[model samples]
Target: MTPRTPLAAAHAAPLDLGGRTALVTGAAGGIGRACALRLAAAGAKVRAVDRDREGLEALAGQTDGVEPYVLDLTDLDAAEAAAAGADVLVNNAGIQLVRPIEEFPPDVFHTVLTVMLEAPFRLIRGALPHMYEQGWGRIVNVSSVHGLRASAYKSAYVAAKHGLEGLSKTAALEGAPHGVTSNCVNPAYVRTPLVEKQIADQAATHGIPEERVVSEVLLRDSALKRLIEPAEVAEAVAYLCTAQASFMTGTSLSLDGGWTAH
Candidate 1:
Protein backbone atom coordinates (compact mmCIF):
# COMPACT_ATOMS: atom_id res chain seq x y z
CA MET A 1 0.00 0.00 0.00
CA THR A 2 1.10 3.51 -0.70
CA PRO A 3 1.68 5.81 2.26
CA ARG A 4 -0.26 9.00 2.82
CA THR A 5 1.57 12.30 2.73
CA PRO A 6 2.09 14.48 5.81
CA LEU A 7 -0.36 17.00 4.39
CA ALA A 8 -3.01 14.31 4.34
CA ALA A 9 -2.60 13.77 8.09
CA ALA A 10 -2.69 17.51 8.70
CA HIS A 11 -5.96 17.64 6.77
CA ALA A 12 -7.68 14.93 8.80
CA ALA A 13 -8.98 17.25 11.47
CA PRO A 14 -12.75 17.47 11.78
CA LEU A 15 -14.47 20.69 10.71
CA ASP A 16 -18.01 21.86 11.21
CA LEU A 17 -19.20 23.53 8.05
CA GLY A 18 -22.62 24.03 9.56
CA GLY A 19 -24.11 27.50 9.08
CA ARG A 20 -21.53 28.22 6.42
CA THR A 21 -22.71 28.63 2.84
CA ALA A 22 -20.61 27.12 0.04
CA LEU A 23 -21.13 27.49 -3.71
CA VAL A 24 -19.70 24.75 -5.95
CA THR A 25 -19.72 25.11 -9.71
CA GLY A 26 -20.05 22.06 -12.00
CA ALA A 27 -21.36 20.26 -8.95
CA ALA A 28 -23.28 17.70 -11.03
CA GLY A 29 -20.21 15.82 -12.21
CA GLY A 30 -17.04 14.07 -11.16
CA ILE A 31 -14.72 16.00 -8.86
CA GLY A 32 -17.28 18.77 -8.37
CA ARG A 33 -19.97 16.37 -7.15
CA ALA A 34 -17.52 14.71 -4.83
CA CYS A 35 -16.51 18.07 -3.32
CA ALA A 36 -20.16 19.09 -2.87
CA LEU A 37 -21.00 15.85 -1.10
CA ARG A 38 -17.96 16.15 1.15
CA LEU A 39 -18.83 19.72 2.07
CA ALA A 40 -22.45 18.77 2.81
CA ALA A 41 -21.25 15.84 4.88
CA ALA A 42 -19.23 18.30 6.93
CA GLY A 43 -22.47 20.28 7.55
CA ALA A 44 -22.01 23.01 4.97
CA LYS A 45 -25.04 24.58 3.33
CA VAL A 46 -24.02 23.66 -0.20
CA ARG A 47 -25.43 25.31 -3.31
CA ALA A 48 -24.62 22.89 -6.11
CA VAL A 49 -24.53 24.65 -9.48
CA ASP A 50 -24.42 22.96 -12.88
CA ARG A 51 -25.65 23.33 -16.40
CA ASP A 52 -27.52 20.03 -16.04
CA ARG A 53 -30.63 20.58 -13.99
CA GLU A 54 -31.49 16.91 -13.66
CA GLY A 55 -28.03 15.95 -12.52
CA LEU A 56 -27.90 18.77 -10.02
CA GLU A 57 -31.25 17.69 -8.60
CA ALA A 58 -30.09 14.11 -8.38
CA LEU A 59 -27.01 15.13 -6.45
CA ALA A 60 -29.06 17.38 -4.17
CA GLY A 61 -31.43 14.49 -3.44
CA GLN A 62 -28.63 12.34 -2.05
CA THR A 63 -27.32 14.83 0.47
CA ASP A 64 -28.62 17.12 3.15
CA GLY A 65 -27.67 20.80 3.30
CA VAL A 66 -27.48 20.86 -0.46
CA GLU A 67 -29.47 23.03 -2.88
CA PRO A 68 -29.39 22.69 -6.64
CA TYR A 69 -28.95 25.48 -9.16
CA VAL A 70 -28.81 25.08 -12.93
CA LEU A 71 -26.56 27.76 -14.30
CA ASP A 72 -23.81 27.80 -16.90
CA LEU A 73 -20.46 29.25 -15.95
CA THR A 74 -20.35 30.95 -19.32
CA ASP A 75 -23.03 33.30 -18.00
CA LEU A 76 -20.80 35.51 -15.83
CA ASP A 77 -23.72 37.55 -14.44
CA ALA A 78 -25.68 34.45 -13.45
CA ALA A 79 -22.60 32.97 -11.82
CA GLU A 80 -22.07 36.15 -9.83
CA ALA A 81 -25.66 36.08 -8.61
CA ALA A 82 -25.41 32.41 -7.68
CA ALA A 83 -22.20 33.11 -5.76
CA ALA A 84 -23.62 35.85 -3.56
CA GLY A 85 -23.45 35.16 0.20
CA ALA A 86 -21.24 32.13 -0.26
CA ASP A 87 -18.55 31.82 2.39
CA VAL A 88 -16.67 29.22 0.43
CA LEU A 89 -16.50 29.16 -3.38
CA VAL A 90 -15.27 26.13 -5.34
CA ASN A 91 -14.66 27.00 -8.97
CA ASN A 92 -14.87 23.52 -10.49
CA ALA A 93 -16.52 23.94 -13.87
CA GLY A 94 -14.25 22.98 -16.81
CA ILE A 95 -14.21 21.29 -20.24
CA GLN A 96 -11.62 19.58 -22.45
CA LEU A 97 -11.12 19.49 -26.23
CA VAL A 98 -8.17 17.42 -27.44
CA ARG A 99 -6.76 18.74 -30.68
CA PRO A 100 -3.59 20.29 -32.00
CA ILE A 101 -3.40 24.09 -32.04
CA GLU A 102 -3.35 24.06 -35.83
CA GLU A 103 -6.63 22.12 -35.97
CA PHE A 104 -8.32 23.84 -33.02
CA PRO A 105 -11.29 26.02 -33.86
CA PRO A 106 -11.15 29.64 -32.75
CA ASP A 107 -14.57 29.51 -31.12
CA VAL A 108 -13.79 26.31 -29.22
CA PHE A 109 -10.56 27.80 -27.91
CA HIS A 110 -12.40 30.87 -26.69
CA THR A 111 -15.08 28.82 -24.94
CA VAL A 112 -12.56 26.66 -23.08
CA LEU A 113 -10.58 29.72 -21.95
CA THR A 114 -13.80 31.44 -20.91
CA VAL A 115 -15.03 28.58 -18.77
CA MET A 116 -11.76 27.58 -17.12
CA LEU A 117 -10.07 30.93 -16.58
CA GLU A 118 -12.42 33.88 -17.14
CA ALA A 119 -15.35 32.44 -15.22
CA PRO A 120 -13.29 31.68 -12.14
CA PHE A 121 -11.77 35.17 -12.16
CA ARG A 122 -15.21 36.74 -12.37
CA LEU A 123 -16.62 34.52 -9.65
CA ILE A 124 -13.73 35.34 -7.33
CA ARG A 125 -14.07 39.03 -8.06
CA GLY A 126 -17.77 38.93 -7.19
CA ALA A 127 -17.24 36.93 -4.00
CA LEU A 128 -14.28 38.95 -2.68
CA PRO A 129 -16.25 41.82 -1.21
CA HIS A 130 -18.68 39.60 0.70
CA MET A 131 -15.77 37.67 2.09
CA TYR A 132 -13.86 40.79 2.95
CA GLU A 133 -16.84 42.29 4.77
CA GLN A 134 -17.38 39.08 6.71
CA GLY A 135 -13.64 38.90 7.50
CA TRP A 136 -13.51 35.20 6.51
CA GLY A 137 -13.64 33.22 3.26
CA ARG A 138 -12.22 30.28 1.34
CA ILE A 139 -11.75 29.90 -2.41
CA VAL A 140 -10.77 26.51 -3.82
CA ASN A 141 -10.15 26.40 -7.51
CA VAL A 142 -9.98 22.92 -9.14
CA SER A 143 -7.09 23.29 -11.48
CA SER A 144 -5.28 20.33 -13.13
CA VAL A 145 -1.83 18.81 -13.59
CA HIS A 146 -2.02 20.28 -17.05
CA GLY A 147 -1.70 23.60 -15.31
CA LEU A 148 1.83 22.76 -14.22
CA ARG A 149 2.97 20.72 -17.22
CA ALA A 150 2.25 20.72 -20.92
CA SER A 151 1.07 17.92 -23.17
CA ALA A 152 0.49 17.55 -26.89
CA TYR A 153 -2.93 18.36 -28.40
CA LYS A 154 -4.10 20.34 -25.36
CA SER A 155 -2.79 23.81 -26.02
CA ALA A 156 -5.86 25.71 -24.91
CA TYR A 157 -6.38 23.69 -21.72
CA VAL A 158 -2.75 24.05 -20.82
CA ALA A 159 -2.81 27.77 -21.37
CA ALA A 160 -5.96 28.33 -19.31
CA LYS A 161 -4.83 26.14 -16.42
CA HIS A 162 -1.44 27.87 -16.27
CA GLY A 163 -3.22 31.20 -16.12
CA LEU A 164 -5.48 29.93 -13.33
CA GLU A 165 -2.48 29.08 -11.16
CA GLY A 166 -1.13 32.59 -11.54
CA LEU A 167 -4.53 34.06 -10.75
CA SER A 168 -4.96 31.93 -7.63
CA LYS A 169 -1.57 33.03 -6.37
CA THR A 170 -2.42 36.67 -6.81
CA ALA A 171 -5.82 36.26 -5.17
CA ALA A 172 -4.24 34.56 -2.20
CA LEU A 173 -1.82 37.43 -1.65
CA GLU A 174 -4.60 40.01 -1.79
CA GLY A 175 -6.94 37.95 0.35
CA ALA A 176 -4.38 37.20 3.05
CA PRO A 177 -4.95 40.42 4.96
CA HIS A 178 -8.73 40.08 4.68
CA GLY A 179 -8.86 36.65 6.37
CA VAL A 180 -9.78 35.09 3.01
CA THR A 181 -7.77 32.21 1.51
CA SER A 182 -7.44 31.28 -2.14
CA ASN A 183 -5.78 28.02 -3.25
CA CYS A 184 -6.01 25.35 -5.93
CA VAL A 185 -6.18 21.55 -6.10
CA ASN A 186 -4.29 20.30 -9.11
CA PRO A 187 -4.96 16.64 -9.90
CA ALA A 188 -3.76 14.43 -12.71
CA TYR A 189 -6.06 12.35 -14.88
CA VAL A 190 -8.85 11.38 -12.50
CA ARG A 191 -11.17 8.41 -12.97
CA THR A 192 -14.31 10.36 -13.77
CA PRO A 193 -16.89 10.46 -16.56
CA LEU A 194 -15.07 13.42 -18.06
CA VAL A 195 -11.77 11.52 -18.13
CA GLU A 196 -13.42 8.43 -19.57
CA LYS A 197 -14.76 10.56 -22.38
CA GLN A 198 -11.33 12.09 -22.88
CA ILE A 199 -9.81 8.63 -23.20
CA ALA A 200 -12.25 7.76 -25.95
CA ASP A 201 -11.69 11.07 -27.67
CA GLN A 202 -7.95 10.59 -27.52
CA ALA A 203 -8.22 7.08 -28.87
CA ALA A 204 -10.22 8.31 -31.81
CA THR A 205 -7.93 11.22 -32.43
CA HIS A 206 -4.71 9.23 -32.33
CA GLY A 207 -6.01 6.02 -33.96
CA ILE A 208 -5.06 4.04 -30.87
CA PRO A 209 -6.96 1.52 -28.73
CA GLU A 210 -8.77 2.74 -25.63
CA GLU A 211 -6.62 0.63 -23.32
CA ARG A 212 -3.53 2.16 -24.86
CA VAL A 213 -4.92 5.58 -24.24
CA VAL A 214 -5.13 4.86 -20.53
CA SER A 215 -1.78 3.11 -20.11
CA GLU A 216 0.33 4.84 -22.69
CA VAL A 217 -1.21 8.27 -22.87
CA LEU A 218 -2.58 9.01 -19.39
CA LEU A 219 -0.39 6.94 -17.10
CA ARG A 220 2.69 7.56 -19.20
CA ASP A 221 3.23 10.85 -17.45
CA SER A 222 2.72 9.67 -13.87
CA ALA A 223 5.39 8.12 -11.72
CA LEU A 224 2.83 6.28 -9.58
CA LYS A 225 1.10 4.82 -12.62
CA ARG A 226 -2.49 5.20 -11.44
CA LEU A 227 -5.42 7.48 -12.00
CA ILE A 228 -6.18 9.84 -9.10
CA GLU A 229 -9.56 9.35 -7.47
CA PRO A 230 -12.23 12.03 -7.26
CA ALA A 231 -12.61 11.50 -3.50
CA GLU A 232 -8.95 12.33 -2.97
CA VAL A 233 -9.44 15.60 -4.79
CA ALA A 234 -12.48 16.36 -2.64
CA GLU A 235 -10.54 15.58 0.52
CA ALA A 236 -7.92 18.12 -0.49
CA VAL A 237 -10.59 20.76 -1.06
CA ALA A 238 -12.02 20.03 2.37
CA TYR A 239 -8.62 20.55 3.91
CA LEU A 240 -8.05 23.89 2.28
CA CYS A 241 -11.33 25.23 3.67
CA THR A 242 -10.49 24.45 7.29
CA ALA A 243 -9.46 26.95 9.95
CA GLN A 244 -6.03 25.37 10.38
CA ALA A 245 -5.33 26.15 6.73
CA SER A 246 -5.98 29.86 7.11
CA PHE A 247 -2.30 30.67 6.85
CA MET A 248 -2.01 28.45 3.81
CA THR A 249 -3.03 30.29 0.67
CA GLY A 250 -1.93 30.90 -2.91
CA THR A 251 -0.52 27.37 -3.17
CA SER A 252 -1.17 24.37 -5.39
CA LEU A 253 -1.64 20.97 -3.77
CA SER A 254 -0.93 18.41 -6.45
CA LEU A 255 -2.90 15.11 -6.41
CA ASP A 256 -1.17 13.81 -9.50
CA GLY A 257 0.14 10.37 -8.40
CA GLY A 258 3.61 11.87 -8.70
CA TRP A 259 3.04 12.97 -12.27
CA THR A 260 5.46 15.86 -11.87
CA ALA A 261 7.94 14.05 -9.65
CA HIS A 262 10.41 13.59 -12.42
Candidate 2:
Protein backbone atom coordinates (compact mmCIF):
# COMPACT_ATOMS: atom_id res chain seq x y z
CA MET A 1 0.00 0.00 0.00
CA THR A 2 1.22 3.50 -0.81
CA PRO A 3 1.59 5.83 2.15
CA ARG A 4 -0.51 9.01 2.00
CA THR A 5 1.03 12.42 2.60
CA PRO A 6 0.05 14.04 5.88
CA LEU A 7 -2.79 16.57 5.60
CA ALA A 8 -0.80 19.14 7.51
CA ALA A 9 2.17 18.72 5.18
CA ALA A 10 -0.03 19.12 2.10
CA HIS A 11 -1.65 22.22 3.51
CA ALA A 12 1.74 23.66 4.43
CA ALA A 13 2.42 27.30 5.37
CA PRO A 14 1.94 30.72 3.66
CA LEU A 15 -1.36 29.57 2.07
CA ASP A 16 -0.60 28.19 -1.36
CA LEU A 17 -2.72 28.88 -4.48
CA GLY A 18 -0.42 27.26 -7.06
CA GLY A 19 -2.76 26.89 -10.00
CA ARG A 20 -5.65 29.14 -9.07
CA THR A 21 -6.65 32.30 -10.91
CA ALA A 22 -7.61 35.41 -8.96
CA LEU A 23 -9.56 38.36 -10.33
CA VAL A 24 -9.19 41.67 -8.51
CA THR A 25 -11.12 44.78 -9.56
CA GLY A 26 -9.70 48.29 -8.89
CA ALA A 27 -6.30 46.64 -8.92
CA ALA A 28 -4.29 49.65 -10.01
CA GLY A 29 -3.82 50.94 -6.49
CA GLY A 30 -4.65 50.80 -2.78
CA ILE A 31 -6.27 47.70 -1.27
CA GLY A 32 -6.82 46.21 -4.71
CA ARG A 33 -3.15 46.50 -5.66
CA ALA A 34 -2.03 45.10 -2.33
CA CYS A 35 -4.47 42.18 -2.68
CA ALA A 36 -3.23 41.46 -6.20
CA LEU A 37 0.40 41.36 -5.10
CA ARG A 38 -0.36 39.29 -2.04
CA LEU A 39 -2.39 36.72 -3.99
CA ALA A 40 0.25 36.56 -6.68
CA ALA A 41 2.81 35.83 -3.97
CA ALA A 42 0.58 32.95 -2.91
CA GLY A 43 1.01 31.57 -6.48
CA ALA A 44 -2.24 32.62 -8.10
CA LYS A 45 -2.36 34.22 -11.51
CA VAL A 46 -3.90 37.62 -10.85
CA ARG A 47 -6.13 39.44 -13.29
CA ALA A 48 -5.63 43.05 -12.21
CA VAL A 49 -8.52 45.14 -13.52
CA ASP A 50 -8.91 48.92 -13.38
CA ARG A 51 -9.70 51.92 -15.60
CA ASP A 52 -6.29 53.52 -15.11
CA ARG A 53 -4.08 52.44 -17.99
CA GLU A 54 -0.83 53.84 -16.62
CA GLY A 55 -1.44 52.49 -13.14
CA LEU A 56 -2.15 49.05 -14.59
CA GLU A 57 1.08 49.23 -16.52
CA ALA A 58 2.98 50.02 -13.34
CA LEU A 59 1.25 47.17 -11.49
CA ALA A 60 2.05 44.65 -14.22
CA GLY A 61 5.69 45.70 -14.09
CA GLN A 62 5.96 44.92 -10.37
CA THR A 63 4.94 41.26 -10.58
CA ASP A 64 5.44 38.26 -12.83
CA GLY A 65 2.03 36.59 -12.51
CA VAL A 66 -0.12 39.72 -12.68
CA GLU A 67 -1.94 40.41 -15.96
CA PRO A 68 -3.28 43.95 -16.15
CA TYR A 69 -6.74 44.24 -17.65
CA VAL A 70 -7.75 47.87 -18.09
CA LEU A 71 -11.49 48.20 -17.70
CA ASP A 72 -14.13 50.62 -16.42
CA LEU A 73 -16.46 48.46 -14.33
CA THR A 74 -19.42 50.62 -15.33
CA ASP A 75 -19.43 48.53 -18.51
CA LEU A 76 -21.38 45.78 -16.82
CA ASP A 77 -21.21 43.19 -19.61
CA ALA A 78 -17.48 43.62 -19.95
CA ALA A 79 -17.02 43.45 -16.18
CA GLU A 80 -18.91 40.15 -16.07
CA ALA A 81 -16.96 38.73 -18.98
CA ALA A 82 -13.68 39.71 -17.34
CA ALA A 83 -14.54 37.57 -14.31
CA ALA A 84 -14.75 34.30 -16.19
CA GLY A 85 -12.49 31.41 -15.14
CA ALA A 86 -11.49 32.98 -11.82
CA ASP A 87 -11.06 30.70 -8.85
CA VAL A 88 -11.08 33.72 -6.57
CA LEU A 89 -12.80 37.09 -6.91
CA VAL A 90 -12.11 40.32 -5.01
CA ASN A 91 -14.71 43.03 -5.57
CA ASN A 92 -12.77 46.12 -4.50
CA ALA A 93 -13.72 48.74 -7.09
CA GLY A 94 -15.55 51.77 -5.67
CA ILE A 95 -16.26 55.48 -6.09
CA GLN A 96 -17.08 58.27 -3.65
CA LEU A 97 -19.11 61.49 -3.73
CA VAL A 98 -18.96 63.65 -0.61
CA ARG A 99 -22.16 65.62 -0.35
CA PRO A 100 -25.37 65.56 1.64
CA ILE A 101 -28.16 63.57 0.00
CA GLU A 102 -30.14 66.76 -0.61
CA GLU A 103 -27.15 68.20 -2.42
CA PHE A 104 -25.96 65.00 -4.15
CA PRO A 105 -26.26 64.76 -7.90
CA PRO A 106 -28.49 61.92 -9.12
CA ASP A 107 -26.04 61.06 -11.89
CA VAL A 108 -23.09 60.53 -9.53
CA PHE A 109 -25.22 58.43 -7.19
CA HIS A 110 -26.34 56.27 -10.10
CA THR A 111 -22.77 55.77 -11.25
CA VAL A 112 -21.61 54.76 -7.79
CA LEU A 113 -24.33 52.13 -7.42
CA THR A 114 -23.65 50.90 -10.94
CA VAL A 115 -19.96 50.39 -10.38
CA MET A 116 -19.93 49.25 -6.77
CA LEU A 117 -23.14 47.23 -6.47
CA GLU A 118 -24.35 46.15 -9.91
CA ALA A 119 -20.95 45.24 -11.29
CA PRO A 120 -20.29 42.79 -8.46
CA PHE A 121 -23.62 41.13 -9.13
CA ARG A 122 -22.78 40.60 -12.77
CA LEU A 123 -19.26 39.41 -12.01
CA ILE A 124 -20.64 36.86 -9.59
CA ARG A 125 -23.19 35.78 -12.15
CA GLY A 126 -20.43 35.18 -14.65
CA ALA A 127 -18.02 33.50 -12.23
CA LEU A 128 -20.51 31.23 -10.48
CA PRO A 129 -20.97 28.76 -13.31
CA HIS A 130 -17.29 27.90 -13.40
CA MET A 131 -16.98 27.89 -9.64
CA TYR A 132 -19.97 25.64 -9.27
CA GLU A 133 -18.70 23.26 -11.92
CA GLN A 134 -15.34 23.06 -10.17
CA GLY A 135 -17.00 22.86 -6.77
CA TRP A 136 -14.57 25.34 -5.24
CA GLY A 137 -14.32 29.13 -5.16
CA ARG A 138 -13.66 32.14 -2.95
CA ILE A 139 -15.28 35.57 -3.13
CA VAL A 140 -13.98 38.41 -1.00
CA ASN A 141 -15.85 41.70 -1.05
CA VAL A 142 -13.71 44.62 0.18
CA SER A 143 -16.52 46.35 1.98
CA SER A 144 -16.14 49.26 4.41
CA VAL A 145 -17.16 50.01 7.99
CA HIS A 146 -19.75 52.21 6.36
CA GLY A 147 -21.39 49.02 5.17
CA LEU A 148 -22.33 48.22 8.75
CA ARG A 149 -22.58 51.85 9.93
CA ALA A 150 -23.61 55.09 8.28
CA SER A 151 -21.56 58.23 7.81
CA ALA A 152 -22.64 61.78 7.03
CA TYR A 153 -22.16 63.36 3.60
CA LYS A 154 -21.43 59.98 1.97
CA SER A 155 -24.90 58.91 1.00
CA ALA A 156 -24.05 57.16 -2.25
CA TYR A 157 -20.89 55.48 -0.95
CA VAL A 158 -22.59 54.23 2.18
CA ALA A 159 -25.62 52.96 0.33
CA ALA A 160 -23.50 51.09 -2.19
CA LYS A 161 -21.44 49.40 0.53
CA HIS A 162 -24.55 48.45 2.47
CA GLY A 163 -25.94 46.82 -0.66
CA LEU A 164 -22.67 44.98 -1.18
CA GLU A 165 -22.81 43.56 2.32
CA GLY A 166 -26.23 42.11 1.61
CA LEU A 167 -25.09 40.75 -1.74
CA SER A 168 -22.07 39.11 -0.14
CA LYS A 169 -24.19 37.36 2.48
CA THR A 170 -26.64 36.14 -0.12
CA ALA A 171 -23.81 34.77 -2.22
CA ALA A 172 -22.37 32.93 0.76
CA LEU A 173 -25.65 31.19 1.45
CA GLU A 174 -26.11 30.08 -2.14
CA GLY A 175 -22.49 29.20 -2.77
CA ALA A 176 -22.03 27.05 0.32
CA PRO A 177 -23.66 24.05 -1.34
CA HIS A 178 -21.19 24.30 -4.20
CA GLY A 179 -18.05 24.47 -2.04
CA VAL A 180 -17.72 28.25 -2.47
CA THR A 181 -17.40 30.86 0.24
CA SER A 182 -18.22 34.59 0.16
CA ASN A 183 -17.28 37.15 2.80
CA CYS A 184 -16.48 40.83 3.35
CA VAL A 185 -13.46 42.49 4.90
CA ASN A 186 -14.70 45.67 6.44
CA PRO A 187 -11.91 48.14 7.10
CA ALA A 188 -11.94 51.78 8.18
CA TYR A 189 -9.89 54.48 6.49
CA VAL A 190 -7.10 52.54 4.87
CA ARG A 191 -4.16 54.66 3.71
CA THR A 192 -5.09 54.52 0.06
CA PRO A 193 -5.42 57.09 -2.72
CA LEU A 194 -9.20 56.82 -2.35
CA VAL A 195 -9.00 57.64 1.36
CA GLU A 196 -6.57 60.48 0.67
CA LYS A 197 -9.08 62.02 -1.71
CA GLN A 198 -11.83 61.50 0.87
CA ILE A 199 -9.79 63.31 3.51
CA ALA A 200 -9.51 66.33 1.24
CA ASP A 201 -13.17 66.24 0.31
CA GLN A 202 -14.25 65.86 3.93
CA ALA A 203 -12.08 68.76 4.92
CA ALA A 204 -13.61 70.95 2.26
CA THR A 205 -17.13 69.97 3.23
CA HIS A 206 -16.58 70.38 6.98
CA GLY A 207 -14.47 73.57 6.86
CA ILE A 208 -11.65 71.74 8.67
CA PRO A 209 -7.98 71.44 7.74
CA GLU A 210 -6.83 68.24 6.01
CA GLU A 211 -4.77 67.06 9.01
CA ARG A 212 -7.72 67.43 11.33
CA VAL A 213 -9.89 65.29 9.05
CA VAL A 214 -8.07 62.10 10.06
CA SER A 215 -8.14 62.53 13.81
CA GLU A 216 -11.20 64.70 14.27
CA VAL A 217 -13.60 63.07 11.80
CA LEU A 218 -12.36 59.75 10.49
CA LEU A 219 -10.87 58.37 13.70
CA ARG A 220 -13.42 59.98 16.01
CA ASP A 221 -15.18 56.65 16.70
CA SER A 222 -12.21 54.30 16.74
CA ALA A 223 -10.24 52.96 19.67
CA LEU A 224 -7.15 53.13 17.45
CA LYS A 225 -6.23 56.55 16.14
CA ARG A 226 -4.27 55.67 12.97
CA LEU A 227 -5.35 54.91 9.44
CA ILE A 228 -5.03 51.23 8.52
CA GLU A 229 -2.35 50.39 5.95
CA PRO A 230 -3.43 48.87 2.63
CA ALA A 231 -1.21 45.84 3.28
CA GLU A 232 -3.01 45.13 6.53
CA VAL A 233 -6.36 45.01 4.76
CA ALA A 234 -4.84 42.91 1.98
CA GLU A 235 -3.62 40.38 4.52
CA ALA A 236 -7.16 39.93 5.79
CA VAL A 237 -8.29 39.40 2.21
CA ALA A 238 -5.58 36.80 1.69
CA TYR A 239 -6.63 34.99 4.83
CA LEU A 240 -10.17 34.66 3.49
CA CYS A 241 -8.79 32.73 0.52
CA THR A 242 -6.87 30.27 2.66
CA ALA A 243 -7.93 26.70 3.43
CA GLN A 244 -8.27 27.62 7.09
CA ALA A 245 -10.96 30.14 6.17
CA SER A 246 -13.07 27.72 4.14
CA PHE A 247 -15.75 27.69 6.80
CA MET A 248 -15.81 31.46 7.31
CA THR A 249 -18.53 32.53 4.91
CA GLY A 250 -21.38 35.03 5.03
CA THR A 251 -19.54 37.20 7.57
CA SER A 252 -17.76 40.55 7.75
CA LEU A 253 -14.22 40.74 9.15
CA SER A 254 -14.01 44.16 10.78
CA LEU A 255 -10.64 45.86 10.54
CA ASP A 256 -12.05 49.14 11.80
CA GLY A 257 -9.63 49.80 14.67
CA GLY A 258 -12.60 49.23 16.96
CA TRP A 259 -14.76 51.90 15.33
CA THR A 260 -17.91 49.78 15.55
CA ALA A 261 -17.29 49.30 19.26
CA HIS A 262 -18.87 52.69 19.77
lDDT of each: 0.91, 0.95
Tell me the TM-score of each prediction against the true structure: 0.94, 0.96
Question: Candidate 1, which segments miss by more than 4 Å at Cα?
Answer: 1-13
Residue 56, model 2, lDDT:
88
Instruction: Kindly provide the TM-score of model 1 when superposed on the true structure, using C-alpha atoms.
Output: 0.94
- Give the per-residue lDDT digits (tens) of candidate 1, residues 183-232: 98999999898899999989988999999999999999788888888899
Poorest stretch of ten by lDDT in candidate 2? 4-13
RMSD of each: 5.2, 3.3
lDDT of 2 by residue, 36-77 (tens): 999999999999999999998999999889999999999999
lDDT of 2: 0.95
Candidate 2 regions with alpha-carbon error over 4 angstroms: 1-12
